[model samples]
Target: MARRARGTSAGLDRHRIATAAVALVDRDGLERFGVRRLADELGVDPMSIYHHVKGKAALLDAASEAVLHEVEIGAAEASDDWAEIARRTAHGYRAVACRHPRVFPLVVVRARTSPVTVAAVERLVTAMRAAGLPDRVVADTPGVLFGFLNGHLLARTGEGPEVPAPVGEFDAAAHPTTAALAPLLSDVGSVAEFDRLLDTVLAGIRVSAASG
Candidate 1:
């Protein structure tokens, strides 16, 4: 080994730090994650992490980026069918959330824009444009599509990967409609529920395309 520098942190890189940070957050969740905690997890001093990632906020961004990488877009994203691309992208996003329920929130709520995010959006619009959707529809596709995914996945992931406890019985006399729909509402995070609603969202997009 060569002579050491005056005072540099050793045996740590940005990727290693990011991977470890993601694991810590996955195990303990964002509320409890901290630079010191991550450093302890990595078996290093806190300053060593700072050397790689700058600080905690940056660390969170790094961790979020690392988790986002697990999303597998596959060949469907490259297909000519815009709706197919959208469905595949949605599945990938949900897969990431399911894999790391605690870390998924950071991927959305963070103010920073990630390249992975931007690329996914690009794929959506490119496929939409290729499908002959009008300009107005293509421009709005990402927000409208992601709104549904984010709202549903956040609730689903928080509920974890179990058969969610049913919404139980609701009185029909006082609030008939609410009572009747209660079971469906409580079925928040099921795979079947996600696919069913995602198809509805696709129908709406198709209407927009047809009208345009």
Candidate 2:
């Protein structure tokens, strides 16, 4: 075993500190993560982490990058089907979000300068360009696509629009129509839903790009 640093718990370095920080957030969540907690996990002093990372924010940036690296886009396919490319990109992003629901928000809120994130964005932009979308649409598509993805992911995590309340619980006397349509209003989010949504968005983009 690596011996502890003198007057400290164990050997420390940027890689080790960052790895521990990512693990802390993965296990406990971002809100519970902190340098002191990370130090405790590493059996070191709280200040020891500052030497490796600037502060919690910098540490979070590292953690976000770490989590994003798990998303694998693989080699680009040798085709110009932008719809397929967009689908792959969307699925890759959703996989990462589903894997780390808590850490997902970090990638969303923090500045995304990670190599993987950059590559992912580049891949999407390339696809949009290949599709012959207008320059403005090419630039704006990412925001719209990601917004839909984030919304869907949030719903998966129970933080987005909620399913309709049970029909039995509704005031049937005052709202007969709502009670009658309760079964139809019950909503479920699933992989099928995500696939359909991606397909629809891509189709709409194609139509919009063609019309302009």
TM-score of candidate 2 on Cα atoms, chains taken together? 0.79
**Candidate 2 stretches greater than 4 Å from native:** 1-9, 158-187
Tens-digit per-residue lDDT, 91-123, candidate 1: 988988888888888887873357877888898
Could you estimate the TM-score for every candidate?
A: 0.86, 0.79
Off by over 4 Å in 1: 1-10, 159-174, 185-187
User: Residue 40 lDDT in model 2?
Assistant: 86
RMSD of 2: 4.0
The clash number for model 2 is 1
Candidates in order: C-alpha RMSD to true structure:
4.0, 4.0
Write down the lDDT of every candidate, Cα atoms only.
0.80, 0.73
Best by lDDT: 1
**Model 1 residue 14 lDDT?**
95
| Top candidate when judged by TM-score against the true structure | 1
lDDT of 2 by residue, 24-66 (tens): 8778877788787888898777887787789888888887777
